[model samples]
Each structure stands twice: as structure tokens, then as C-alpha cells.
Target: MKVKQKSICETCRKQKIPCDGTKPSCSQCRLRDLCCPGYQSDWIFVPHTAQSDRHSGATVVSQSGIVGGRKRIKDPRPNPKYQGARELTVPRVLGLSVSHLMTLIIRSYVPEPELASLDSNSNGANTYSQPRICGCWVEVLPNLIAKGETVALSSAVRAFAVSILSGGPMPIASLASGLEAYSVALRSLQRALRSACQFRDELAAAIMCILLAELLLPTTLNSWAAHLQGFGELMQLSGPELYTSGIGHKLFVGARPSLVILGFLSRKASFLGTDEWRCLPFGLQPPSAMQQLLSEAAVIPSILERLDKASGLPPRDRAIVDRESLHDFVAVLGRLGQWETYLQSADQYPLSWVKADAEEGAISCRWFNNITDANVLTHFWAFKVICLQNIDELAGNHPGMTSSSQFSTSFRERVGLSVMISQSIGYLMQDEMKLFGPSSVIMPLRTAYDTFRAGSSQCKVELRQCNEIISGILERGYHFVPLFFEAFRDAQFCPMSV
Candidate 1:
């Protein structure tokens, strides 16, 4: 019996993906300059050739890696900086007597492969260095001028929201508890915003900014005379601290745009339910998952109440009309949906053990314990979008807010603004203020915008930088932060490179 010729490896046959085929080196292997498995009956192809010619190209021909006559010829590209990491350490902030700037601590963790694969020549270069101290720093956000020494010793009432969301290692309960811890800052920011709401135009803007300073100052590292005795402690607490900077520390205030952007982010964040899940794919999706997700926002009785009052909308489609309302409702639904699904069946992604251990009690078959990795990032990005929209609106000064009816107005109040504000402030907190409560998360944005009417250049820059950072992180998780750190440092310190 005569047997026909065997098929080539998919990678080699297509060349679109990696493949090895032929001779001692098949056509695919030869193309990649590898010792192909050679006519081996079992079409097994190693992903890459050991002797890779990828970087072996001579003078700029194949700058990355060149293949020549079964050899990986070393490319003669000049090494931009020798000693790899060490050489890259020269403070980009070289000569200028730059202030220490703001006291917020931002330490970036760079992801490899994705971040490393990027061209170092561009703003997307790879480097995950921790935050370094630079002599020159600038704080443009101003302190609110006050007389008589802010001596109001009023008894401050607090909102203590205890979230029993936690069931186990997924730590929903713990996170909820931690979130309540931040009520202190949230309440203060809220009070400031509400207080400013009672004030007139210019003063409102100023006071609104002063409250923004609570979040923004910590983010931008700005402080002043009212910051308390001595400089050392102030400098020490400068990074991400409210109302203070450290000794001989360089403090910087975020400009108007930065403040506005924070508000926008908060607005975006509000759309992502505190306990919801959202999945993002490249194409169209069945509406069931979406419908299921939208139902979760029912936890926020207010949105559901407004959605009900806007009674004319078809029951099924009611949650889908306005972006903010739709987003929040869906977000809440997805979270609840995820929990329900986890109880039914657990997915293999997120490297979770829900499948094996659910019956064993390591984690529950309940809602909070079944959180997926995909869900976490999904909510993260969703919030970013809401924030971005606000950023865009604020950047352009969204003046045409007039709607044909009161529905849009109600929608904005119920869900829109909250989502936008959360996104902005979320980005601003790259440090200790990491975990957040659903309500507290959206405070900065609402507070800032309810007070300030316009965006400033500083606010814009920070927003752009932050959005880029968030985008990077969403795409590549932790690694993206480092690249941003390098780009940010290079720009803020050296600047010429950016």
C-alpha cells in the first residue's frame, strides 16, 4: 500500500504563527534557521529554533534578530545604554533644582515580555523601578487661604457602612471592612463638596479645589503653612497624604485639569458596581449575560428607583438606554451573576481552584468567593471607560447637557456622575488608597465637579498620564505601571526624552 505525504506543521504551513517543518530543517525550520525535526513522521515542532537568527542581522537590516544561513547573526545595532538596568538609573531629573514635588508615593511594577518587547525609544519603554527621590519637584495646586486658624471643633458624624460581602479568601468581607476605614476621607471630602455647594461661584470653585486637594494633594504631593509643625514629618507623609508635605520635601499641586479628571474618573468608577463583574470581548455578545449583569445594580435601590420612574421604557430595555444607568445596572448584575454562576460551575481561568475545592469548603460555592480574574479586570476597565468619558467631557467642557426630557437628567444624577468621578479619583490613588468602598470611591469626582466648573492643563496632563497607565495595566496587568513610571519620571525629571 502506498501512503501519501504527511501535512506540514500549522505554524510552518501558515507562517502566521510559529511552526517548524522539513529536511534536518524543514521549509519552516529553514525560514527560522532551526534544526528542523527533519522528515520526522510525528509532526512535532519546537516553538523557536535554539540558534535564533532573530537578532543576528548586520547593520540595521534585521535590527531585532536576523536569520542567515542557519545562523543567528548578531546585529550590529549600537547598544543605547550599557550595563542594562544600572546604566538606565541616571536620574532623568539631572540639573534643575526641581522641588521634591508632591508627597504621594507611586511605585510602579513593570510587567515583562509585553512591556519589555516595546521599543525603549518610545514612551512605552520597559522599566519597573520603585519610586525614587528627586530634588526638584513642583506643586501647582494652591492651598486655600484661611484666617483665624480653622479652629472649628465641631463633632464630626461618620457613616459606618459594614459590608458583610466577604465570605472567605476572596476576602470580600475584608475589603468591605477596609473600605469603611476610608470613610474618614470620604466624609471629609463629601462635607467639603456639600459645603462648597452652598457657596457662590468663584468661592465654590476655590473651596471645591481645596477639597480636591484632599485627594489631589495626596496624589500630587502638595501642601502648605497650615500643614502643621516642622517639615520632616510633613515630608515623610507627603506622598498621597491629605493636606501636608514633608521636611525639605518638594510638593506639587495638580492643576485644574488634574482635579477635573479625578472627578471624571470617579464618575466612571461609579458605573462599575462595587460587587459586580463585567466581561469585555472583541465582538458582539448575547444579551443574556448583559441582562443578568444589569440586574445586579438593583443593589443600588436609587438607580433602580429612577429606572422605574422613567416608566415609559420597556422593562427589558429600561436599563440599556443611558450609558451610565445602563452601565451601573449591568455592572451590578454581572457581579451577582458571577456569584450565581460560580455556585453552578467555576471557570478554569484565573487559575482558580473553585472547581476542586468548592465542595471541600476551601472557598464557597457562594457569590463573593467565586470572583474571577477576568471579572476583576473587566470591572477595572469598565470604570476606566466611565472615567475617560468624564475626562473627555470635562476636557471639552460638556456644555450641551440639555436633554429632550428629564430622563437624562435623572440618569446623570443617579448613575452618570458617580461613575465618572470614581474613574478619575481611582487613577489618582496609585498608592495606599488602593482598595475602596462603592460609595467612597465616587466621592472625589462628585465633590470636585460639583464645585469646580472647568478643567485645567495640569488636570489634563495627569488624566492623560493616568489613563495611559490604567490602559497599560489593563492590557498587561502589573507590568504596565512600571513603563508609565519610567515615562513619567523621564518626562517629569528629564523631560527631554519624552
Candidate 2:
């Protein structure tokens, strides 16, 4: 039989094998039992007519025996609407993204329920005021940054986020980016502050972001004070109108703890005690009983300031000042006692003894059990220690005399209180630690650590445990931990084993 010469089948061509060029199927496909994909016929050469003409590179013949070239059609481009259809979907806040980590850090400061609700809502707007609700900044900040609503505030948030991330085993690139963001944010904040009218909310938010950043990031001790001061100035400048809004209320409530700490550290009254704060509805209501205690505790600083001034005077002069300040001191103590009574009676935080197995012995630890309650109790005890320390100072007792057998009884009591506070702190959730921030625990822990006697085993053990907790906090990517650890070391009566 004569073999026909034809184009190779499509399947044979694709397989790069020779074809028998059969009409129905290729020999290779037939022999292998594979279905053949038929091939197109080869183009046939045709003689062109004299009347044919080229039009747009294509040959054509008119009815009048004139040939013209057909216009070449361009391939259609993809529709812009469907161009991104095949792209992989991603969350707005991916783990590596600065904004994503910021959202995590910010959410850490907020309650879980609020975070869940915020995640569920498309808009994430705060429609109502609830004590347990997460701050509006936590929900709104990521969106604001995404939308480029406020460059200064967004940069500040990014700076803060990157700084927190820098504490972890991050790439060198991330550390450089964090530094760049910090520089940009600081410069932007200065400009924003200069043009306050245009960037009121942005400026306020930036102040808060920077304040929190200062608290969490490695900085000079009490560097957050400047930001807190600026925040207060801005709030005063903006007036009550600012606090009336939902976001404003969230910002104020979220920042109140820092303000209280600043007040104590500065030995002055908290700005939250001002009439402007008093006038605002949200400001009038403390978020929790603990917050109220903090606000009330602001008076301690003012009283201490007076006592310190009085102690510096001549004996005759000091006696007059002391008598005059006596009434105020008594009233402040009375208020503090009332707070203690309320705390004792508060059913929300039930006290419990937690027994844990330790190397020394089976230690029974006293804690409120609840994280917030434990934090509050710890702070309260620290405050009491401060009160006692101050009272001791006012009574002409030398600082070095605390270890004397005569004063040893009170010293032991203080030491026991400090131990309990440290133990309570260990029970706090990682989320609570972030929410409260390092500033919340630093002073209390320092106060507790200061009560220790040099070379005392109990004191050394407590310091070691506190240091371990601080180390855990460091591992969690809080940059402030190392600074706090340094402060703890500086304040330690003697070198601790840990």
C-alpha cells in the first residue's frame, strides 16, 4: 500500500515523535492505543490574481476584481475588573507587615471580647460606651493607617509596632525599618504639634502612640513623662469637646493609667484630677475600681511633696507645717482607708490562697487570682509600702535603720507584702501584662524589691522570681523589659542569683 504524505497529528507533534502521517490517526498513537488529536491541513500555495492587493498586511479581492488587505485585529487585553481575580487573597495585617504586628500589640491592650466583636464588624466603629470595650484606637488605628488618614499618627503606630518586634529575633532589616519609622514619626509629630488645628486627633493619637512606645521601647527612665505631659497639654487645649467623642473617651481611659503613674513619679496631682477631666461624663466614671484607686492615689504624691518640703524646714518651722498638713494627711489616709475597705468588701475579686510546689517547700501564695484583681492588689500593697516608708521618713527614722531589730517587725511585714505582690504578678496573663504595660508593674515591683534586706535569702529568692518574670516578659517581645530589669538590678539590695 502507498503511504500518504500528510501533516503530523497534534498528539505526535506534542510528543516530538515521528508520525506515519495517516488520515484517521498517527501510527504512534494507534500503536500505543492513545487517542489522536487530529492535525490541521498544511497551507496550500495559491497563485495570486493580478487584481489582488494588500490592505493592512492582509490580502483581499473586491467584487470588482480589485484585491485589498484586511485590517489586522489586535488581541483583546484583559478587563481591568477581572485582572486581580486570580491573585491570592490575604489579610490586611499579615504577620510580617508592620501594621499587622501593630494590630496585635494594640489588641493586646484591649479585652478579648472587644477584639472578637471588632473583628466580626465590617466597619469596626464604636457605637456605644462600655467599660469592658476595647479602646477605639485599637480597632480604628489599623484602618486609619491603611487609609492614610493621618501620616504622623500612622508613623508613630508603625514605629511602636516595629520597636516591639525588634525585641524578638527579627531580621536586621526590621530593626533598620523601625529606626527609620521612629525618626519619621518624631519629625511628623513635631510638625503636627505646630499645626494643632489641622491635626488635633492625629496629634493626640500620636502623643499616645509615642507615649506607649516610650514605655515599651528602650528609652531613658521616665521618658514617657514628656509624652504624658504633652498629652495633658493637648487635652487641656482641646477642652471638654475632645472627651465627649467615642474615640476621645477611649484614648483618655486607655491613657489614664499612664497619667496616674506620671503623677506619682512626678510627685504631683494627676491631670485627670483637673476640672476639665471632672466635667467630662466618661472621665467622671473610672473604668474600674482599680482605676478609681489609682486616681485617688494621685493625692499621695501631693501629700508627700508637702511632707518632704516640711521635713526640709527648721524644727520649729517643720512643726508648724506638719500640724497644718496633718489634717490633709489624715483626710487622705481616711480616703485611702475607705478604698481599702471597698476593696476588702468587693465581691468581684475574691481572695484565694494558691499552694504551689517549690524547691524550698510547698509555698502557699496569697493572690486575688483574677489578673486585674491581682494587679490591683499588688499595686495597692505597693502603695501601702510607700505610705509606710514615707511615714517612717517623716518620723525622723534613718533609711538605714529599717533593718534594726526595733524596726525589723515592720520590715518583715513589708517584705511579706512585697513577696505576695511579686507572686501575684507571676500569675498575670501575658495579655494582661501587655495591657497594663511595663509601667504598671515596674514601680510596684521596684517598691517591693526595695524593701528587701541585703543578703537575705527570702529577698534574694523574691528578686530572682521577679527577674524570671521580667525575663519572660522580654521573651514576649516587650522591649521595656530589659530596661525594667536594669532598674530592678539597680534597686536590688544585693546581687540576686538569677
Candidate 3:
């Protein structure tokens, strides 16, 4: 029994590359160093016949025309009505814009079977594949878009998708498209807010998408902060109960870090500091290590709020406020320290702590296991810095409350933590880990920058380093970073030491 050969091999056909019509395997596959799965056997080949088909009125094209013996029609375009027998294919995203391509691709990327594979077992061992940040972008937004429940959400998602597809350092075209989509999303969101028509979950998801767009491609300095304020309002409307399960719960968990930052920006107590928010979002499940750390950090903003109020009081009243705030600050600092110790003691914390760098024969630095670890650790340090600096300020103002020696020690510890953040920059900016994006370091690095006075030598060094990282981030297409830098440049969030 003889078998018929195919015109192309499977590998070449899948790649959309030209295949040399070969029998066993194509030379293109060998040239490209790919294993050639031989041609599929399902196809039935039909040989050319000279006789005209009467059943379908099909006319066979001959090699030669009777006008001239053995003369072929070299160009077939003139015969517009004649169609080829072979199958014709085009690339999936060939004619669509980048944003459209992203929309279609992500929506279909994960099916039920693939999503189920993400459920890893105990001990952090996964027998199946999953994304690094599970269910946030790949799963959640796509699923929401699939439902088509809200236009606001779909538009916001397209805007975010464009940013991700750009892979940082977004081009002018993508930038314009993303901004246009973002504008549509913003308007749709406003309409949704006005009419009070969209479901709480859809509205919340749209707001989350808008917030991410601002972070990725912000038009104004306060856009991210402003959107965060709106997100806070929605959270209030839905209440903590709404976030106890499903998509609402995921958005709340994701928004926690941003809300904590919002507390710093507003210099006011945050809702996240309340017992309900701190404990309820996790529902029956306990908060993860990061979540617990975030809860501890959320308290710092309230301390700042109290400190602000205390500063405005009369001397007698100020003293009373100072003492209470001092105790609160010290306790917050202690809790943050405990969290740090516990994290460092965890097995996963030090996957491979090799020496990453040595600066001028002093102060060796270590790279973290991944961007997640480094980012979380730096954030922990930033929160501690805020608490320690505030404590130092309140104690110094009260003079008799804290000794000068103790103040100096607190000052030195905070400075050390700031330097530690700078040390982690090298690890965070690595190209390999860029999937985590440069947005992770924006708040933490900015916090690290505030630890030193404007004219101090240390301040100059940290400023230059931060500027370089910000430049790298922008070059990678996170254009909104400079806007954040400008907004935070003279921010009065922290009390600078003398």
C-alpha cells in the first residue's frame, strides 16, 4: 500500500513560513532547527483531468491555451472568477489594531480547563501551569469582558491590554490609542456612576481598570490619586460584605496596596485601618503574609493624620496629642519589625540570597528570589521608614519625651532602611523579571528618596539613582512614572530630619 505525500510539513504550516513541497520532511524545518511533524494524512488529493465536469460546470485550467501550443497563462489575476482548490489562510491578528488584537487574544486565552490548572496544591508545588500574578489580568478582566455586562469595563480593559501588549516603552501610536480608549472608558464610567445602572461588581472592575491605566499612562499628576479616591468611595458603597467573595473580593485585595498609598497621599486615616477592612476581606481564609503586612502599614497614615492635627494644637494640647501619638507610632514600628522578622524567617524568603553587588568595598547587597519578594520587602522598609521618621519628629518636638541619643538611633535605623531600598533597585530592574513591571518600585523608591534632606550628599546620590531607574522605567514604556515623580517631588507626606 502506497501513501500520498503532502505539499507542506506541519511545523512549517503552523509557523506560516514557506515550505518546500517535500515528501518526508521539509528543509525549512531543518534550517530552523525545528522537529518536522510530517504532513497530515487526512487530505485527499485529486489529479488534474482534461475533460470538463458537467455536474458542477467546473472547467479545468490546462497548462497550454489552444491559441498557442504549450503556452500557459502565467498570470491568473485576470481570471477573477476562477478560485484555487487549496485552502488559504491569514494570520489571526493580521488586519486588526494592537488593542483589538489584545482584546480578542486575552478573552480567548484561558478556558475552563486551563483556568483549573492554576489551582496549585499545598507546599507551593504546582503540577500545572499558571501565571505569576494569578487571576488578576489574565483571568479576571478577560472573564468580565466575556460577559459584556458593561461597556465601561470593556473599554477600560482594552486600554490596559494595550499597555501590556506594548511591553513597556510604548510607542506613540499605542500611546494615542490607549489614551483614546481610556477616555472612552472614563466617560462610560462617569455615565455609569451618574445613572447608577451598572452592577457593583462591574463598576468596581471598571474603576480598577481605569486606575491601572492611569498608572501605566497617566495624563495628569493626580489622576491615579483621584481614581483611587473614587475607588475608595465605591468600596464604601459596596461595603466590606460585597468584597467577601468573588470578583469583588479580588478587586479589594488588589486595591489594598493602593489604598495604603492613598492614606499617605491624603495624610488622613484610611478605611483600610478599620477592623472591618483589616479582617473581613479574607473572609474565612486567613490573610496572606503580604496582606497582613499591608494591614500593619495602613496604620501609619492614621498616625500621620493624628500627627498633623497635633501639630496645629496649642502647646498644652499639643503635648497631650504628642504623647499619645508617640506611643502609637512606637507600637506600629514594633509590629512592622515583628512582621519583618517573621518574613525573613520564612523558608521561601531566602530562596537563594547570593551577594548581588559590593559598593566601594563596603555595604554588600543581596538579590532577592524574585521581583515579588524584593518589591514586598522594599515596601515593608518604606512603611517602617515613615513610622520611624514620624516617631522621631514627634519625640523631638516634645524634647523631654525621647533622649537625643535614642532619636539619633531611630534616625540611623530609618536611614539604613532607606539605603536598603536603594540596594534592591538593581535586583528589581533586571530585564528577566520585567514581567512584574517597573510600577512596583515607584512608591517605595519615592519613599526612600524622602529619608534624606534635599542638599545632603546621600540625598544627591539617591536622587541620581532614582532618576536613572525612572528613566529606565519610562524607556520601557511606563510613561506615567515621571508624572508621579513630579507630583511626589515636594510632597509633605513625611517629616524631614535636620
Most accurate candidate by TM-score: 3
lDDT of 2 by residue, 407-443 (tens): 4565566777777766665555334334443445666
Show pairs that collide, candidate 3.
Answer: 168-476, 168-477, 169-476, 169-477, 170-477
lDDT of 1 at 305: 45
1-498, model 1: which lDDT tens digit per residue?
Answer: 956344355435444544432222345664577544323255332233334324422111122221123211121222454112111100111111111111010101111121232344232222212111110111111121111112110101011111111111011123322233233334554465455423222222223223322221112222311221112222223322221232111222112112222323322222222232122210132222222333232234344344446558764454343445555544654565464565346434432222333333121221222112222322333433333333233223222433334333433342433233433433333332221211122323333332222333324443443344334333322221222233344444321121
Query: For model 3, how does the per-residue alpha-carbon lDDT over 1-498 read when each residue is reduced to its tens digit?
Result: 855436778777677788874423357975677767756666332332344232323322121110111111111111224344321111111223333333332332222233233223221112222222222333455345545656766666666554433223422223444565567688888898888843477777677767766555635556668788878877776678777766666667667777788788689898889888888877865666667788898877887898787777889998888899889988998998898888778765463354845667343454776545665778888888888888788877878988999988987787777778777766665544432435566667777766754325746665566555556655555465555554333452212111
Candidate 3 stretches greater than 4 Å from native: 1-138, 163-168, 172-174, 197-199, 348-365, 454-463, 487-498
TM-score of each: 0.21, 0.65, 0.69
When sorted by TM-score, best at the front, the candidate numbers are 3, 2, 1
Q: Could you tell me how far off, in angstroms, the CA of residue 372 lies in candidate 1 after the best superposition?
A: 8.0
Better of 2 and 3 by TM-score: 3
Runs in model 1 lying further than 4 Å from the true structure? 1-80, 84-346, 349-498
Ten contiguous residues with the weakest lDDT in model 3: 64-73
Assess each prediction's global lDDT (C-alpha) against the native.
Answer: 0.28, 0.55, 0.59
